[model samples]
Target: MSGFEVAGVVIGALPLVITALSAYKQGKEVLASLRKFRGLLDGLIHQLQTQKTAFYLDILEHLREAMVPEILQYGDPTEEKCVGILLDAKTGTQMHDYLGPLHEPFLEIFGYYEKYLKEITSQLDYIVRLKDAPKDDLPNIIRASKIQNASLVFKGRLKFTIDRKTLDALVKDLGTERYSLGKLIKRVKTKREWEANEPTSSSTTLTLAFARVRESATLLHKDSLEVPTITVTETCDQLIHATARVQVKSICDDAQHSRNQGRVLALELMSDALGLSEAKHKPHQSYNISTTLADFLRDTAQDEDARMSPLNQTLLALNVVSSVLQLRPTVWCNIPWNSMSIRFPIRLEDDLRIPVCAPYVELAADANLLQSHTCSPKFDHDSCQDDHARDGHSTVGDITSQVHGGLGNKEPTRRHGNIHGPDACCHLLVGVEHEQIIASPCQGD
Candidate 1:
């Protein structure tokens, strides 16, 4: 069979397996031995459903993009009717014509998974049959007069016949295959992004670059803001095509009246931060910013002149506190609150003296790890400890000591004295006291 045929077969088989497991689970009576497999069955069902959905939505979307002519010949690939027609067994010949050109690529991706899919389906089919078999049709030993209890007999028969180890191995293999498929999708996405930005025969104009950034920023805020507007100063171009200095103005009523209200903060796109110039040459290579908040703080600590003025320090502290208060409850707080994740934008000629730009939180590859870390019982104290440890300090002191020690300050300057107390708890601490203003800690127990 062709690779396209094989993919259809595997995807079609998934729903059958899920339905069998779900039906068995809903059966009026379940043997004690079989009950142990409930959790595994449920997990397998969920995994299979997720895999099927990914195949339909993510994998097919990429495939459709790659084979636009073939897909477009039929109808709109994004529409459910078109997707259904492609996956329908009745249209196998039509799909083969459409997918024939991409056969080798599909085979390379899905060929090895064929055996796994077959074995899983076969095993599940057998299990379903076993569940439906009557006592009279069972083997002599299981139905023997010596075994009085039917449940016990069924349990014994299952223990002897079912290989739990094999089942577990199958599930693990399925998970590995799913992960591999996800990586493949990610590669396709990266390729698409690169292709989208590949310089045409014509030189990239500032207007085109601005339009692209505006489109992206609009999509980013489409769900949140009713009318998202991005304002970029034409002259604020350091890396013209690579970076655009844009302001994220607030349309919300409360945000407009907040501190640093109507501020035109400098923006840095992740693509630029990851080095777009180098990315063009080495597409697959992962790049991160060399300078983090830790590096910045260490350099600032050593150079007293580079440190912010008392008022700016107070403002910096206030911004950190405000961001935490505003964003903590939202998905924005799903990040590791360490110094390394915090980053400042590349400074411009007209940038604020105190680094008025909002600090960017660079996400790690494994976002779940950061989320779990943030949700930990001792997250508050532990986050402080992480900052302290990075600065070569062994113990976590009060917010003031943590901040001052991180900055290599022997004593808190009198001008920044008022920044202490419960208000000073934050991931980023800068000391230069303003007497009238009391700053709150960004994170506290």
Candidate 2:
């Protein structure tokens, strides 16, 4: 009722009102800050996505550029016949700079590292289990070799992430920046020096093999911090080169068992595909007797039994792969080639295993097919050879006595396929598309 009482009530409410107003202002500021943060986060995501897009695009572009020089740019069809063509290589400097960007949106490097870590760790664990393992321990030796390989990769990829320039140690008390990479770096350098000092010129294939290994390893190198990719790839490259050298040697020296190791499986795969499954299990004796594709071809030409033998398809498959190698050496370096199918321009009602010189195969002028454009896959199609390509550019050229003579054997099995006429020079074509990744289990070799 009095003025004093009304003033007391107003004063009590005043403090509450001021506190509420302060809280509202603070909440608005927090909300505004959050909005700004969200905007920045979105921008970062967009930028990262753009960078990844560019990275993958660059990879595709690089692949395109590599192929275009070999096959795409050739205006003349005859020039595309790369049976004996040795492709020109890109430069080392250009290769070093190929992966323009390091970061990936897909985060493949993380996965890659995870795989490497698991593998190497497992290997190391295995060695540890064999306490005080001898230097000659087979498994230990294998794992150590892998470690050395990883070490090499670490060197090549040194430029990608951590700057080699910044590895210098700034000793606080000494006030000096000493060059460093700790102990392993010295070991790697010493090993490299030792390798460099070794006599290599005496081995004609050494340079070529090492070059192959380096070029192959470059394909796996990328700018990434997550994966230890370089090491695994380097090891793989080295192993492949070593294996190739050994295999080439075996072939040249006529080391029958060694040379026939993987080729036999490949021959069987081709034979099985060519409706000659019986030859898949053909005794190793057969392969020992015939080592090279030319040997098989010669045998097939001389003997009627050879035409029906698995060697017939085996020769064709080897030739095809050889042809492809002439064009793209890197493609088949790892492929076991367990399965392949070929089709001739001459159509059959069913899929026929028509033989053609493989994409990279180089057949001798004298090594004529017993039968031109001949295959055993029930060549039932009535469509003429001319009808092969939708356009006039025939996908396969007909085999004739003019180019490759017919097996000249009239085995009823060969007669099963409908051969319209064997007049055209058979254009042997492979079924595999270019630039395809064959992830199938090709480690058979």
Top-TM-score structure, candidate number = 1
For model 2, state the Cα shift of residue 114 in Å.
13
- lDDT assessment of candidate 1: 0.44
Clash count, candidate 1: 10
Q: Which ten residues in a row have the lowest lDDT in candidate 1?
A: 241-250
lDDT of 2 at 356: 30
User: Model 2, stretches more than 4 Å misplaced?
Assistant: 1-39, 65-107, 110-297, 300-445
lDDT of 2 by residue, 1-445 (tens): 1221221222222222223223433444656534544333233223323333332333333334334344345544231122112122332223223322321211233233223223322322222212355422333332343354443322111011211222111112112212111222234346546656886653444455546545533433321122222111112333333333333333333334434563332221221111122344423322111133454355557877546444435445544543332233232243232222121222233453232333323222322322332333323333223344333433222222211122233455644333422211122222222112111111111
Which residue pairs show backbone clashes in model 1?
Answer: 415-433, 416-432, 416-433, 423-439, 423-440, 423-441, 424-441, 425-441, 425-442, 426-442
Cα error, residue 366 of model 1, in Å, equals: 85
Candidate 1 ranges beyond 4 A from true positions: 31-38, 67-109, 126-162, 177-180, 192-445
Model 2 quality (TM-score): 0.15
